[model samples]
Target: MEQIIANGLYLGAQYALIALGLTLIFSLMNVLNFAHGQMYVFGGFVTYTVVVQLGLPFVVGLFASALALAVMGAAIEKFLFAPVVRRSKRDESTMLLAAGVAFFLDAVILLFFGEKQRGVPKVVNGVFNWDMRIIMPYDRILIGVLAVLLIVAFIVFMNYSRSGRAMRALAQDRTAAQLMGVDVSRYSMLGFALGAMLAGLVGGLLVTITGVNLGMGGPTSIKAFLMIMIGGAGVISGAIAGGFILGMMESVGLTVLSAYGDITYLAIFASLMVFLAVRPQGLMGKPWG
Candidate 1:
């Protein structure tokens, strides 16, 4: 039972990290970046290279991956995405643009890596046993701890930091924030860069916990999409709630229906559909003002 709980927490933490950035970006920019998951895959691959090929420590690999993706994200926002935003006739254009980016990045990764799973060395080896039973990997526990810390840090930064307040202001009213002389473009760039950093950090952690594969992007993206939808379309709290909810559901589903793990999503979505029918605005999300 303890092991099951631990597994659920671990999975929830992973989902939280995956969905957090998307939550922030969508809330702040109203841009649903479809390539978010691909950015994560890119981070995993970069982390693997930094650790395995460059003989760097895992910490260095993580930092390098985050930094690299932050720059890439900012560049994409500035060069590729901003232009489209300026000229787009409908909001869906950004979604399609993001899809194009996702496909392009996936193709590039496939061309180079050839669809092979890349293994990452454990940040920590061995398992810690509590009392007689309840065994779990130290690395996984460490990763979970970091994920929680990051989540908290993000919340704090958003609430207390100057830049954080600016972001919130922008999310609440873009035109008003712009009128107030907030650096609109800079914050958008900052938002993308920071969101990409979180995604990259999660990716590196994933590499440490599981392994990297080309196909990871699609599933991660789907999970992220459902998380936002379940939580609330643009609510960070909703994303967090939805992630843990989905994680626990998957954990229990795997335990009970071991052979039909995928059924968990069906159950989750069914529940979500029912909830949306009743509340339409999501768990933490407010109806539009």
Candidate 2:
């Protein structure tokens, strides 16, 4: 039971990281970025290339991946999303644009990497043992610690930084924020870049635990989308709450019923549907007035 709980927390941390990025983008842009999974895959590949291939340090690999994704995110905003926002059309166009980009990137990855599952060297090795039976990997512990630190840093950044405040203001009301002298485009790009960077971080951590491949992006994106929906769309706290909830549920389900893993996902979606029906705004999300 203790092991299950610990495992759940570890998985939940990753979910929260991914969902937080999704929520940030959705809150600011009112569009779901379908290409987010590609960012994760790309981040992992970049980290693998830098650390394993180039023999760079793990930290250097992470930084390189983050920087690469940040640039990609900024460029995407400038070229794709910016044009869509400028046009007078339904937000569906933005969704389509995002999907197109995701598809294109996925294809490119398949072309380049074929269909190989690649893994990264663990940043931390060995295990932690407690008392007589409880044991867990130090790497998982590291993931939890890093997740908490990143969450705290994100909160501080949003609350204390001027740019973060601007982002919040824009999320609340883009037109009002623009009138108040916020450079909407620049902030939009910033939000996207930040989200992408977070995704890259997730990718790096994930590669340590699981192998990465081209097809991994689609499932990851789906999981992220489910997390954002379950947590309540456009709510940061909701994302975090939703991630833990899903992670715990999954862990418990897996522990109790190993053969029925697929059923666990169904249960999760059912819960999400129920939540949407009852709260609509999400568990931690505020209802728009």
Cα RMSD for candidates in order: 1.6, 1.6
Residue-wise lDDT of candidate 1 within 1-289, one digit each (tens)?
7777878888999898888888888877788878888889989998999999889999999999899889988998899878898898887789888899899989988997668889688889889899745788899899999999989998999999999999989888999999998999999989988888888989988998778889989888888988877788677788888788778878887887677646766877788789889988777777851
Candidates' TM-scores? 0.95, 0.95
Per-residue CA lDDT of candidate 2, range 1-289, in tens? 8888888888898889888888898898887999989889988888888888899998898899889889988899999898887894787789889999899889877886667898887789899999736688888898788877888788889889999999999989999999999999999999999999989888877777785899889889999888777778778888898888788888988877667656877777887788789877777777851
Model 1 TM-score (2 dp)? 0.95
lDDT score at residue 18, model 2, on the 0-100 scale? 86
Name the regions of candidate 2 deviating beyond 4 angstroms: 259-261
Q: How many Å off is the CA of 178 in candidate 1?
A: 0.9
